[model samples]
Target chain A: MQSFALYPFAPPGDVAALRADLRAWLAEHQPHDDVVKRANCWASFDPDFSRALGAAGYVGMTLPAIYGGGDRHPLERYVVIEELLAAGAPVGAHWIADRQTGPLILRYGSEEQRERYLPGIAKGELYACIGLSEPGAGSDLAAVRTSARETAEGWRINGQKIWTTGAHFSHIMLALVRTEGGSERNAGLSQLLIDLDTPGITIRPIIDMAGNHDFNEVFFDDALVPHGALVGTRGQGWKQVTAELGLERSGPERYLSSHALLIALIDAAGADPEPAIAGLIGKLTAEMWTLRQLSMSTAAKLAAGEDPMVEASVVKELGNAFEQDMPRRVRAIVDCAWDDDADLARLLRALLIASPSFSLRGGTREVIRGIIARGLGLR
Target chain B: MSDARDMLCDTARAVLRGADDIAPVEEVGFALLLVAEGQGGVGGDWGDANAVLHIAGMLAPDIPVADVILSGLGDVSMPHRAAATVSLMAGAMGQALALSIDHVNTRQQFGRPLGKFQAVQQSLAVMACEVAAVDAAAAAMAARLDASGFDADAAVFEIAAAKLRANRAVGVVTSIAHQVHGAIGFTEEYDLRRVTIPLMRWRGEHGNDARWAQALGRQVASFGGRGLWENLTARAG
Candidate 1:
């Protein structure tokens, strides 16, 4: 009789054009000469590359033009980030600031704060890191003991923050702390924009098994900031961080972490792959395609200003599982000898070491499932 | 969820309710839900029939609802049994998931429920992921079918992906569903085997994971990388 559709049949024309522009820019500017560095992709920290990207106006696209952003829709930014990620571009330097922090500030920052940080962030000069996970409280973010006491100057922050990515190099820390003390889990929390160089703050790198010093444990012992440091409202950190996480968990980066390895697997397999190997490739492609659609749909929701907490969690949970399983599955298909010089072998080796943290970084597998369970009314 | 689609779904559910046998379902017009108008039946599209397929799957009815519905679309050469097999496996997985959850909570080992064990929970968690992925894929396929008719060449990738992913999921879901049930699931008398055996048999029908995967792989290869991304993100307009 009659058919109907819920999802879009084709991407907006502007999005397709943006995709083409990004593809061309990446081809001309990306340093494809260094295989290992390129293999790092989003995790590779190259300030110069980020600066060039900013100059090209690919960063801070979703913010208002009044604050030096492109003032485009979130879907536009989604397109750019997806291209950068799939190509394994070195976007780590501005990844956090551009992806979520700038948007967070745009949404909640005071006029002065926006004028102070948005321009620099949009220009890709400023960098920021999330300050949610603590040594005592990671998945249980409400258990944050980092206290932000009222001071005549502004706020004095004291506590330890762990798993803070880009903390050492980043200029700002969106620290979540206990502003009003009580036994309540999520209340009494506030987000403060802490300058990393502020006094009494110490950042020591916690090198991962891959020997990458990307994340750190910061000791915020009475770190001081001026009155303009508070983001949104006091006692609203939990709410703000929850929104920020929706941005974090529902992007193309969630699933493209192991993309380099997939490409390498293809090259190693050659045109004539074994039937079993082809089958594995097919499985990976199908799952990735499905997750990609789900993620893009979530981006559409976010662009439409809908809070898709449940759908975002689905992306992270399923995406991370597929990413983490890539190395194992590729190993099954190819003869991974773990030689450092061979490209395929080296990529597989790096993925093997790095894959364990895929689930642990955004949210642990157990914690993500709990969120999904709650969403599904199973909990 | 239009008025017409909603009514058709209600009628289909009512007609197929408790239809452990296919004869009664055919006696009603439920079998012609996908038949086009003027074809001696009420006309409906793949999108409308998708709801019926999903509910039939969830209810785990033995009637060949998906098959009969597919046979009505005279132009397409799709095997009716293949469509039925997909829904059957999906429904069987749902039943297995529900049954295994109950088994884990009730069956005890070492004076505690099996679900209390960390290992068991982790396994169940993985199984849950598979089920979720399959569910999402099915819904996505339905939406895609609604937007672009199933006859369009563009729909092949999604159709292949959905069937491929669903077939792949059944293997993992059935394994874990059985693992958690232990010997009880292996026995013929237990209700779990009934669902598991059909799932095992359906896993090979209408082209299994490997078959659909090959089709998907050829399409991706022909399109190359850039076209591949276009195919993936084109749904966000």
Candidate 2:
């Protein structure tokens, strides 16, 4: 009775204007003609597109103005990202940085580091990647063996990070490394902003099942960085990383990756949505609604300046299913394929290719579930 | 917002927890459920009644107090039942019954926990689906009650729908829970014995699923042919 429409995170006042401005902006600037015409052909190394986003001030609309950001609410950022991703914008270049890294740096980065990184990130001129998952670490940060040896110059990093998205095209990596070998598994871990082109770092692409050039493995052999590169503090990387994850995992992107396809699918059905079709839609809509409320509650928890990791995981775990299931559900509903012109055919195709990454990229569904179970007082 | 309802629930929960060690309670459970104050376990109607049902669920995996309350009211009180309580007066979380069943440690024929069986899990999951329906219906109704006064017309449909959906779970989830527990599930000492009996008895008490459905359908046809989905919302609002 309240509203069937879920995930209306917009505050009542600015929402209408925001939606109008966004729709107009999106219509005027469709994805690069090539992207719209075909799907799965995205190249993550599109700097020109990134720069255009910077000029439009879409990259970092929520950070403070002094840092070259619009200093808007995260809710606005949430809606903007949903619209961009739904429209299939070539945001791969700035995706991680804007979504996770920028926020990480803003919230926990040292003052000088923020001054250095935030403006560049807001401009979309700089790129960033997370160097968290190690070769043997699995999802357990406690297992990380990446060591950062302190040098007079700063820190020398030596370890390999795997499953890092956009690692091949990124300019910098905010890496997590163990600075001390004490029994404290979480202690002694530190975050270093390692330059990808540094002397001892190598990046190699690891093609996924979809043959996407999105993810890569990185070898950090004594990579050098000044002391200022240490985000937060040494031995505090574990805390900083966990906090950053709360931002990374929660938000609209969790459920909206398939929204464009869902909308198009519904529009194709016309006025009387078939009962069988409506059942699927109703089920999907309900699941999405639950995840959105959980996510919004998480965001509300964050706005109150709490960790919200457990809540984030619950949302992400559920959210990923809703996102990943969309393409398969569309296919199952009526044997629809990537080439159907009923409406936004190319967009549908993009979802087919991109849906697999929905769970793996942000955090694997298994990992999210682990967080959720632990949150629910499980082992 | 009512203090009486809040206290009634607290008492119900306390009674349910302490009920585990007690012998199978078969002494006109409804009469005991509505003694007005201090006559037996609980002492109020709908709110107290269903709160006992929900808490009873945790202690005794198969208890159908939720359904019993709904149908008892539906059969005896008639119109008031339609206006007042939905099976969803029992506040719920997502897939609550399913998730709770996961913790039931009863062993099956295969020498494993019943939860270890896919068939049993699926059955329980259907119960979870019903619980989710209740979650949706209850959330909508609660939000309405909070924002404005409840409208009787809208309340009838929501209560009927919620009862129709969630009331079914008493038979479904509790039955499976008992099946998993075997003969012990029905015994006086086994803790959750009354669950199935109450759920089954309650289901057909207030005219069964058919009766409510017919009324709902007739009401739909009464309003100028096309279903008044929006008019229903106006009452809800």
Candidate 3:
């Protein structure tokens, strides 16, 4: 948990080299399909590409060496993730474990857990999913009714986890469950690592409004696990969960989602741009700069082992709002009628379909604003 | 990173903020821009000197003789337009920056400094960047005042951009200042009252930044992908 330095953040040095390399790699792996399938450039579960990336030593990039990680810079991993996302790499296979789960396990897991789990993650041999939100609880996280009870052998897990992305393909679900009951909420909560392949554990795909199978309705009916499956102390889940959420909340991926569309819109808008277009680009560009600073600052803080939960949420909430607004503004400003099946336009349409869940998935705007206000001591 | 301008600006700041003889401050801030050696102004490119303009505006918001002089700004070519008003706007911005900092530094929130809040700090950072960039851009444009001066319309765009970012920065900064000062910032007798009122007037006095950016973007993009960034970089470097 040692802190890292905030280096100069402009064009030059390793940063520039990394940018060039990433761009070249992206060009080679451009999704060849005629129609944009999932707007997630890395939409397909391509084990070959995953292993290729892992072989190239790009996986588990932020973890320490002892756990088989490449032990590179987290900021470097950030650049990598952003490059992949921007290039539309079908990174779904290795995304979850690489992003937060691997980092989480690296930080808080037991030696056995780290040795067993980290290597596979590094090679993209294993995929992981976060199982936090349940159907009933929504943003009221402490109200999660998923329960785990101690047994002679180990622990018995029950209840459901909804909107669990990649659970069908993932090997494990890092679940937040109630290990024990208390008079108040958040009393006996704990995080448990549940094997998705374990008997009685079911992952049913939840087709979203976009008609995509990225999400799942996971059910755990007496899923059995060893006592060692617990991520941390029983009641420490609240604290642990908050930290995990922070990782999920902060990153360039939170923004830059519709970057390709922005490029397309700019190209489509034709040569002599209207003043409105110029002004819009200028304003968005300004917001983009400010938000990038805010996000990277929070990440630097995190690398330094500081809990930037409030700041992370602020960045995510605002960044996503900007991202989600991008498509609408692009459509409004660029008047060409796009077929729902065209390349970039189709992708734009698909994103429009999925846009509602963008904010709701991470954390609702109200929840985030409340946190921002709390951070400011206004509420 | 530039040092001399900062030093000059530091001194200008002291005179404007610390020793304010009202009308004279405006006169001196405006006088510094008058190129000392050349026929026109050279202090325009010097950020530190531009700060003196801000000093003048804050010292005497009602009688902005400098503002009146720049108001004589008309009929410059497109490229030179940015520099012309910029050469003129430099002082007004100096006034705004000084006023913003003075107003916000004393402004309090939660019974402590208002600058303590992350939100407020973010706004201040933006204000600082706006003030600095406007100062530098004006300084750079002014250097070419005699040769390769921007066209008349460029002044409108340059002034628009400067005024837009500044206006937006001030709106944010002023709100925070008032919030920190609580009811005091809004009070007519408070030091911030004059500064805050003039912030709006100066912003509107010239073309807004948003209007200018849009106008420039329309011109540049429509004019065959013209990249004016290099122009900025050469001067900034």
Candidate 4:
């Protein structure tokens, strides 16, 4: 495996060009009209905004051009994502589809599946959510009790998924479930692509403490799907899902969740804030800068058709610590209250509420640390 | 292909592995990796220099690697030394972290190894994180040097960041290593002080985090947010 470079190379010329074009478009399309709403950033779901982004060809840059994508490098997509997250753009609606689902389908889905889903995904008309975590399976996804049995016409999925973000608004779900029986846990698992509107499916919203309807508990009771719905090979779901999980962890989203708060911190600190506060800002910014470079390097490896599982996990674990730590540091430095009317206060409150989930989502801290230790051969 | 660089690194590592001294490395011209080909030295890229610096740092040699390498480049200033110091300290911190990990795992307390304790593991984890960050900062600075070729003006902000971040890491890494090793780490007999003391000395050399932070603040304030951001995201041109 290649080690992290002392100085990773720069993004390609097209990446910078695309970033400029996106910045200009954002300047006109997304202003700071509502600071609180913008604070939601990638978490803010807006179908119309997603459609606009799709029309501008910003969503699916890494997919094949024949499938309605830009056929660009992964770093190009990375540049767009970094800009969107930095400016706190409303990208939740198309984020999952653009990030992983489109690539997953392109890589693992059959011809019919790719033809049917890829175009819509590129156009941002389709939305999707992951179905790995169940009520009993948060981090231990292999323990998913969601079993799918072979039926006369197709497969019948009878189980439930929890913390399925955007499932309520999503059009499809690439669900992980058991297709085989007996003692082996991972060997029995498989993935099924089920349309959200299937008759036996139910999606209920779970409001976060931030009072945001961002999570959902999805129930699938004998939800029937055609044989074509299986992604990749049966009994290979564990391998496929773990491979894609690397994609999930390799984005700017991992660290940029609370970027808006940091910017607000700088603005609120004024020209001559206390030296201690100024030092804090510099430290946070420096950490962010280094992490961004690290993330970009991970993307470069992905583009070269390499699996950066360990490096990707490192970025996620470190990024999560920084994002979760930023709010506490800001609060400690500047005494502030949660005033809905105050911009900085609102942003701070939003970050504080959202911080707990930083390490919990994707993979929890313990799970990630274990992975890092394993990567280092310590385990 | 970096064959020469790799050879140099392997040679330096072999020479320094258990030497307990830096004299052998200097005698072999290993410290001349960055001293320019025309200057009666082995001219290599920042990457090569970094490899040598990492080895020299792990040993915490009595003979100065940064001063030897930087001084050879003619009129060496504090800022230049500061940049090199950051990379050098990162190497030392990395060595210290590895030593601490080994000590806690091997040396037992309360009928069990200290690393088995959650509190000890947590402290070690924190130390590991700082070491990684310092390593990254050093790499980033080396990359800048590779692109801009020691153009001090182009690298001022980054050099400040590297030095400041590395200086901070030295503080955390040294203290945590001491904390983990307990009494043995403080004594002269143990090898822990070899790296920790170098970290302590390097923390104040060139310029510490506070000094670099002041410079960084002035740069940010002068440029404003937009300019600072442009600087931050500016790719190698």
Candidate 5:
């Protein structure tokens, strides 16, 4: 088997200056709130921060200028994303819209759809949630049974989408629904950009173990959306969603989500750490640095218009492992109590509880490994 | 990769294949790979060295290809040696992964290839991820070294991070490769050991995990938490 080569992550135009501007902006605007908020900061909902960030042109960066976007390169967007994630900025409000939905709409949505959503998304006011998982379609996404029937008025969507993150707050959902009758598995699926406020939709909170309501159970009972809501070709949702996932999985978020903990661990360790702490820090840093390289290369490949499905899966697998193991590894060598109130202890405790979903979300560990196996030419 | 690097890799692979020592590699004048063109040498960059060493690593694990390549620079530091070893380790780990994949796909178990088993596929998948990580690390480190003009001290952070990451991957790559290969991989005749044994050695050679980790950890601590991210982004792109 051939080994993976690092795709050159060359974002045109002064990247250092881009980073500097974002860093300076983040310094002025990012809320210095609870330390725990900084540790899974993407899930932290702060519309004001997201809007300010959008106003500053950090959101919807890769979209066309006609759509109120900055018309930046994808790698430029990648740099902005990595900076936002690393700083533990509260990016939840505009994360999905900017990351995937905006691009998906640009690439696959009709002109009217783009005209309706892109401006708001670029403005950071329109949030979107993915509707892929159902009660029966967690890992086997092809098992999705959410149906959207065609009508003269519009498409009527009827289904229950479980674990829909941001559905409670999102303005729209780019859902994968069965548009063809008797369609089974992956075929006959189509994407519909449903307005969340459509008459028959219901979004109820599904509180996580951390008592966080970042995700929800969104049920649609004949939720009527405009006929123009369909994204891309009919019966092509499977392919489109798969492509959207490429955007979802390999960004800096995969590894940088738990960056707050690393920062906490480092600050706690101080300049002169004991051998154990020092060793752990070193190992973690090495892994993080290596992961950044992999993630960036994958982003570069994506920017070059290549589908790095396997490469993206590799990043998610390794990045998930690193994020999950950090809390446990720190707990092993540190003398902090689980109930302690120190920033390190609290961050560790929060991450220990939240780590289980790190591998589960985006894609489960098994599914990601299977993707890697397929890339390896294994059945 | 540039045409020049591709041609260099071609020559390295041809000379190093099935060789018993570094003599053929020496005769091929690989020692001049990193020397300045004005100084009567090839004037190649670290990326060229990485590509060649990667080939040498796969073809001649027992050979001191890295040593000969470094000898071109007259005197090299520990970080430089560590950087070279990372590329070599990447090549060998990649070979181990390729051999393991080939074995599982061909070796039958319960009336089918072992690779047909989910257990085996998952194990190999994990091994592949580690191999991919090392390969990416080695390549990135090479880029950093090239950007820094082969100054070991200047590229110390990349060297420490890449070498340590590669060293840590040795366990996963070697164990999983042998695990998936079954008893046949344990034999000296198998091609797996040709790379695995060298990987195990290289993990501890220029700098062990603890040594590099401590050094890197100390450096990062000095950078502080925020400063670490700043320095990392600034140092590269």
Candidate 6:
């Protein structure tokens, strides 16, 4: 059994200055949108905001400067994103590209691919979405049946991807597709960076119960991209995608998605709140503080070039539970209605609806727990 | 961990193991662990104290190891006690997790080890997460205390948050540890209760969930919504 140790989260350079600069930038540039938009701010798409943020050099802080990046440290990027999330900045547009795609492209993409995509990603004009979850493969991602067959022109893709967030607006998609005829499970899968505007690709909106079109069902009907689109190595999509998820799961967004609600709760409850409200605030704050510690440690571990797979899973599991339970717990303690128009009430209702997807997205609670169990030397 | 702290923990584990009382613990000179080297003491910091107390928490939960170590300070405040209790609870929770993992891996049900079952794995995973959270809380609290030179007032937010988080984890850690262990875990000879019982007691010691929650909540409320974030980031980085 591996005991959890706190990795030293010492970012290089001036982190306080980095935070102050970002906060100041957000104050001037961040939209004063509806408070509900700030609750799950990462999913709130504001292309102009993302472009301005990218122009300000916060988007691709870790990429090399030649690719229009800041050449900053990974922890510096971590500080920037956390500050963005905590302040509920709308960062959905360039989020995927900046967080994973840019790094992945820089690491594995060919020089041509990097030259083509990295600058746009850094500029926040181009967007990307992951194509992992298929209809038959949600938690069981190894069961992905989306096929990409090699041909004279390129790799022709034919499959359907459900629950693809931002597919409609994303310029490209880094998709996992089965490349071998008979290979099964996690083997023989290859990742292809496909242009979303290909002739055969069609993206249809999947309106969620919240009446939000944040997700879509994307159909790749013989969508062909050039051979240079293959990222890293063939038959290594499983490994690459797993690494990408580690980047996805342990981020500040996992916990700070519902930060707007907490802020509203605190502002609504005056300095001297009722005991029950105060107790609830304390409980939430403690969990949030502890979560931040765990998350930063995991980030530091990642920055130190170690695979913190289990630690990342631990953060995702606990963070999902915390964010999901906040609305229900608040509703139980505070007097709020489903139809209330106050910020707290509106934020509460929106999050209560959004909370169900918290664990379902990224990875389900059971899947994350299984990963932790595997790390525990069990199964 | 530094070599000196590793040696301190090694000494703590060796001296405190199987000892029924605090005599062996005191004999190890743990009382002077936090004292200055100029004063003929170890001159160890709170990080060292946290590490040693973690070992003592695993090896001798019934002993007053925290008291012995804090005796170097002459007077210990409630927040300091709370910080020490968080470390102890972290160690105990870790032990409970280890014991449960061992039991499930060995105890067979149907045709395989209990750990092979999805249900059992999920339960243990939850327990592991809670243990990790408490461990993280304790470690972060220790860092804050060391940063503030052991002034509990300066590190009150971390102490309160850590203690409250540890308190919140007791039920989850204890219940899952026993649930995965089956009937054998209930026996006095079984090692699970050695840590679980201490964790339960420590949850109410120093400060319970309500006490720390109200303190931390009111303190954060005073910081206001946005100020809380500013204050937290400023305190750490």
TM agreement with the true structure for every prediction = 0.88, 0.69, 0.71, 0.92, 0.99, 0.99
Off by over 4 Å in 2: A1-13, A32-57, A83-90, A181-184, A336-356, B1-237
RMSD of each: 4.1, 8.4, 7.9, 2.8, 0.9, 0.9
> Candidate 4 residues B105-215, lDDT tens each?
788889997777766765666666677777777777778877777766678777877887788777778888899888988899988888888788888988877777776
> Residues B1-237, candidate 5, lDDT per residue (tens digit)?
899988998899899989998789899999999999999999999999999888877879899999999989987888999999999999898899889889988998799999888889889889988988998889889999889889999889999999999999999999999999989999989899999999999999999999999999999999998889999999997
Kindly list the per-residue Cα lDDT of model 6 for residues B151-223, writing each as its tens digit. 9999999999999999999999999988898889999998888998898899999999999999999999999
Model 4, span A1-379: residue lDDT tens: 1133333544566656776799899888774546666655777888888888898999888889899998877777888888888888889998999998999999999999999999999998899999999988887877888988988899988989999999988999999899996636678888889999988999999998988898999998888899999999999999999988999986888888677777777776667756886777777776777777677777877777788787787788888988998988888877766675577788788788888999998998777766655453344
Error of 1 at A286 (Å): 1.7
Clashing residue pairs in candidate 5 are none
Docking class of 6: high
Per-residue lDDT for B2-59 in model 1, tens only? 7998887687678666568777667766667766678777777766776677667656
lDDT of 6 by residue, A1-379 (tens): 4586579999999888999898889899999999999989999999999999999999988989998989999999999999999998999999999999898999889999999999999998999999999999999999999999999999999999999999989999999999988999999998899999888999999999899999999998888889998999999999999989989888999888899999999999989999999999999999999999999999999999888889999999999999999999999999867799999999999999989999999999999999999999998
Q: What does the lDDT read for residue A369 in candidate 3?
A: 54
**Interface RMSD values, listed in order for every candidate:** 5.5, 9.5, 8.6, 3.3, 0.8, 0.7
What DockQ results for candidate 6? 0.86
lDDT of 3: 0.62
State iRMS for model 2.
Answer: 9.5
Q: Give residue B139's error in model 1 in angstroms.
A: 3.2
Candidate 3 backbone clash number: 33
C-alpha lDDT of residue A215 in model 1:
95
Rank ordering of all candidates by lDDT, starting from the highest: 6, 5, 4, 1, 3, 2
User: In CAPRI terms, where does candidate 1 land?
Assistant: acceptable
